[model samples]
Target: MNFTVVNKNICVDNIRMGDCSSASIFLVGDAETISLSAAFDTPPESLIVGPFVPLASP
Candidate 1:
């Protein structure tokens, strides 16, 4: 494919994140092409299904 992008101005104030476990992107400008892929392969014997525990904040 072919395209054109003309970005004049972009402003980002703040981006707060706690936890992330996959592919992510934060683009503020033009891009011709973008590709993202994520894969998780866990063994059957190594999987843990336990109780939910919240993380203690500082």
Candidate 2:
């Protein structure tokens, strides 16, 4: 999954991670894309994000 700020000048803050045994998260502000790689035997729960304006992925 991916997320970004509505305005390019603005950025998402207060990031937190949870509900997964192991995963790699890559955040690219220049391209405005957050990539996630999850490793688990079963489906993992959703990630949590703090209150912030969300922008559509390019």
Candidate 3:
């Protein structure tokens, strides 16, 4: 894979967020190469199925 990026003018005024998860990417500048990967494995014995419960307020 090859990429040629040319950025003349880039402006970011404001960025507002409430929550950011584990798989979140925030880029502001240019990049030549970027590769991201994720893997998750859950065994059958460790799987749990139950009702949903909201967390209490602090």
Top lDDT model: 3
Q: Which candidate model has the greater TM-score, 1 or 2?
A: 1
In candidate 3, position 58 carries an lDDT of 34
Give lDDT per model, in order.
Answer: 0.67, 0.51, 0.71
Off by over 4 Å in 1: 1-22, 44-58
Superposition TM-score, candidate 2 onto the true structure: 0.25
Give the 10-residue window scoring lowest on summed lDDT in candidate 3.
49-58
Clashing pairs in 1: none
TM-score of each: 0.35, 0.25, 0.45
Ranking by lDDT: 3, 1, 2
Query: TM-score: which candidate is best?
Result: 3
lDDT of 3 by residue, 4-55 (tens): 6778998989977655555667788887668999665987688787775543
Model 2 global lDDT (CA atoms, 0 to 1): 0.51
lDDT of 2 by residue, 1-58 (tens): 6665574565677766543332334454655445656465654455555575444333
Off by over 4 Å in 3: 1-5, 41-58
Which structure is stronger by TM-score: 2 or 3? 3
Ranking by TM-score: 3, 1, 2
